[model samples]
Target chain A: MKAKIGWTTNRLHSFAGITISLVALFCIPLLGSSYYDFLFSLALIYSMWALGYNFLLGYTGLLSFGHGAFFGLGAYTVAILVTKFSFKPFLPVIGIAVLATAFLGAVIGYLCVRYTEVYFALLTLAFSMFFYALVFKLYYWTGGSDGIGIRPPDLFGLRFSAIEYPAHYYYITLAFFLISVYIGWRIVNSPFGKALQAIRDNPLKAEAIGIPVRRYKWYAFIISTAYSGLAGALYAPLFGHVVPDLFHFLFAGEVLFATLLGGYTIFLGPIVGGIVFTVAKRYITAVTIYWPLVLGALLVAVTLFFPQGIVGTTYSLLRRKIGIKGGE
Target chain B: MLSGVIRPTHGKIYFMNKDITGLSPHKIVKMGVTRGFQLLCICSNLTTLDNVRIAILSHMGRIGRVFSPIDRDREAYEKALETLKTFGLDKKRNLLARDLPHGDKKLLDVAMAFALEPKLILLDEPTSGVSTSEKGKIMGTIEKVIREKGITALIVEHDMDVVFSYSDRILVMHEGRLIADGKPEEIKSDKKIESILLGVG
Candidate 1:
C-alpha cells in the first residue's frame, strides 16, 4: 500500500493561502465602508452560486447555460412567499426556495442530462429562456418585469431598519457563503465528488466501471441548483427586490464567466473569481460606459491565454518556480 | 451489444436469464456485465488508487454519500488498495493514471473492472499497446484475478499466442459475422479460422 500523502507541501501552501484570505474576509466589514460591505456581500452571494456551477461544469464536465432559472426560481419563491403569504421567518423561506429549485432542477436536469456538450448547454439555455418568459409574461403573480420587492427578513423576531439591514444581511450572506463553501469542499472531496470527476475525465470508463453516469449527473445538477437557489434566496433580501432579469441568460453568462475566470478545476477558484469579477465589473462600469467591451476583451484574452484559469495558472507557476513537477 | 455500449440490430442479449438488449451502458453494468475499454480509459487525471476507488464506490453504492469523506471510510480505501495490489499496481498507487506505462494502464483498467466485482467482464483488448515482454505478465495477472474471483471474461484479442494460451473457448468474427466458435485447439487447427486469422491455409 502506498503511504497516504495526506497533506503535501503544495496542499499546505494552499491551506495557508486559504487561511490568510479567510482571515482577511472576516475583517472586510470593519475595515471598509457600507458600500464596500454591500459589494462584498454581493460577491459572496455570486461565489456561492458559482461554487455550485463548478460542480457541474468543472467537476462533472456538464456545461449548463440556464442556471439563472434556478437562481430566479429561488428568488421568486422567496418573493412570492413573503409578499403573497406573508412568510416572516427566513429559515422556512430558504428551505422552501431550496426544495422548489431542486424540483425544478430535477425536471430540467432530467431532460437536459440526456444530451451532452453543446446540446446540453443549449437545452439549459432554452429552459432558462422559458423561465424568463414565464416571469416576464405572468405579471399578476410574478409582477412581470418589474419583479417583487422584499422586506428584510426577521430572524427569530429580530428585525432591523433599512440603515442596519445591509450590514446584518452582509453578515448573514457571509455566514451562508462560508457554510456553503465548506459543504461544497466536503462534497467534492468525498467519494461522490471523485466519482463525478471520474465521469468528467472519462464517461465511457465511468459507465463501464458500473457508475450510473446519468443518475450521478442528475444528482449533481440538483445539488448545484440547490446551492444556487440558496444564494438567490439570500440575494433577494439583500437586493430588496427580485426581478425577471435574474432569470436572464446574461446573468447565467456572468456566473459562467466567474467560474471560468477563477479556474473551475480548483476548489477555491470560483470564490476568487466571483469576488474579483464583482469588484472588476463594479469598477469598470464606473470608469466608462464601454465596460462590456472591456470585459469582453479581457474574457477573450483569459480564454485564449490562461485557459486553466487564474488559480490553476498561478499554482502551476508557483510549482514551476519551486522546481516541483505537477501531480501526485 | 452485451455490455450495451452499442445495440445489435437483429438479436437480444440474455445475461443471468434476463434480456438486457438496448439497455444503457450503466444499466448493463448494474446487471453484472461490465467492460474494460480498448483504449486506456482510466481517469487519467486521478491517482491509480483513486481510479480503482471510483469503481469501488460505484459498486458499494456509496458514490452518493456526499457528506462523508472517502478517507473516513477505511473499508473502501483498504479494498481499493487490495485491488491495486492484486494487479501489482499498489506501488504506483499515488501516481496519476496518465503517468503509468501502457501495461500498467491496461492492468488498472482490468483492476477497475475488478472493483465492480461483476459476474462477467468484457475486455476489449487486454494487452494492446503493451510491450511483447510485458504482455504475458499483465495477462497472467488478469487471468489469475479473474479465476480467483470466479468471474467470466470475454476477451477480444488478435494475438494468436495469447488467444490460444489464455482462453478456454474462442470466437472469430468476419465482417461482423461470427465465423467460428470453439475450443482454442479446434479453432487453431481449423482451416477456415487459420485462413481468416493467420492469413495462411
Candidate 2:
C-alpha cells in the first residue's frame, strides 16, 4: 500500500512538471509580443546557465563565482567558429563549444576542488578573473571590450535563418532549455547525484567510506560547465552577438541570484527566478534607471523573511501542513 | 591494505601512500580514504537506506548510469540491508538518519563508511556519546567488519574499554605525538599510559 502511494506520488510529480513546462513553452510564444518573446528566450538561456550553477551549489555544496568563465568560453567558441572557420552546421559548433568548456572546467575544477567552502569559491573567482584578463588582453581574437557579432545560420538542414522571426528563435531556445533541464534532471537523480549530495553533507565522512569526493566534485563541475557552455552557445545564435559581459563578475552574480531566488532544491526554481528577474529588470529599467536599488531592496526582503527562496518556502509550508495532517 | 593517515603538518594529511598533504578534502576521499566524523554526517533529508545506498554508489562507473531502478537492484539493496542488519538498524532502515538517536547516528556514520568498502576506515571518536550498553553493540559491529571483511580500521576513540576491547594493537597519543605503542594489555599497564591517563606524566 505504501509502495503504491510512492509510485503515485512519483507519477504525479513527473506529470505536474511536464505539464507546467509544456504550458510555459507554448504560452510564451502566444501571449507575448515579438520583443517579449525575445526576452523570454533570453530568460530561458539564463535559466539554463543558472541550473548548471545550481548543480554545483545546491548538490555539491561548492559555491563557484567563476561559472561565467565557462559561459563566456562557450560564447567565444561560437564567435570564433563563426568568424574564423565560418562553421556551416550549428550542431558541430555547439558540440565543440561543450567539449572545450568541459575541458576548461576540468582544469579549473581540478585546481579548486581541493579547497573547502569559501576558499573553493575564492579560487574559482580568481580563475574567472584570470580568464577575463586573458580575453581582454588578446583583443585580436576576442574583439576586446567591443565584443563580436555573428549572424544566425541554418540549423541542421532547416532554413531557420530564412524565417528570421523571434517566434522561431523562441522555439529553438525553448527546445534547448527543455533538453538542458532534462539532462539536469537526469544528473540530479543518478547515483552520481547521491554521491555528490553525500560530499555536500560531509566530505570527510564521505571520503572515509571510500568515496573519492574530489573526483566526484570535479566531474560535477565539468558537467555543470558543459551545460553552461551549451546555454551560451544557444545565446549566441539567439542574440546574434557575443560580448565580454558574458564573462563579467556581475553576470556570474546574476546566475547565482537566479539560482537562489528560484529555490535551489526544486529543478524549476532557477527557471522561474530567471524569468522573474528578466521581467523585473525590463519593467523596472523602463520606469527608472536606479533599478538596482529597487531590486536590491526586494532581494533583501526575500532573504530576510523567505530565506529559502520562493519555491523552497512554499514547498516547506505545504509539506508541514499536509505532512502533519497525514501523520494524524 | 589500508594506508595510515600520516599527518605531515597541522590540518594536513597523507592517505593511501599518496601525498594528499594539500589536496582538497574531496580529492583525498576520492583516492579511497575517508574519516567518519564524530557527529552524524548523513544527508539529513534522506532515509538511512538512502544514505547507505549513496555510499555504495561512490564507486559507480558513471553518473549517467544512476537513474534506472536497475541501478539500485537486488544486489545494492541486499548489501544495504546487510550493513543495516549488522548494525542492528534494519528495522529503522526507512527512518531518516537525522531522526536516529545519537548513538545510532554514530553507528550509521560508521555503516556509511563501511558501505564505501574502503581499504582503510578512520573513525574519529566513534564511541563518543554512546551509552555504556550501546558501546558494546557499536564495537561489535566494527570488530565484525574488521574480522569478516579483513578491512583495515583506524579508530580514534576516547573510550578505553571500547578501544582496548576491539583493537589488535594500540597506539597512545599525547600532545599530538605518538607516546606509546604495543599490545592492548601492555599499553594498559604502561607507566606512560597511566601517566597520560592520570595527567601525571
For each candidate, give its TM-score against the true structure: 0.93, 0.83
Docking class of 2: acceptable
Global Cα RMSD, each model:
2.9, 4.7
**Candidate 2 wrongly placed segments (more than 4 Å):** A1-8, A161-164, A324-328, B1-35, B43-46, B59-74, B91-96, B117-122, B131-137, B140-154, B163-196, B199-201
Clashing pairs in 2: A114-B24, A207-B34, A208-B34, A208-B35, A212-B30, A213-B30, A214-B26, A214-B27
Kindly give the stretch of ten consecutive residues in candidate 2 chain B with the minimal lDDT sum: B1-10
lDDT of 1 at A153: 70
Residue-by-residue lDDT tens digits, candidate 1, B1-201: 788877899878899899898999887877788888887788988889999998888888887788887778888899999999999999999787988988899999989998989999899888888888999999999899999999999999878788889998988888788999899889978987787776631
Model 2 achieves a DockQ score of: 0.36
Pull out the clashing pairs in model 1: none
Best by DockQ: 1
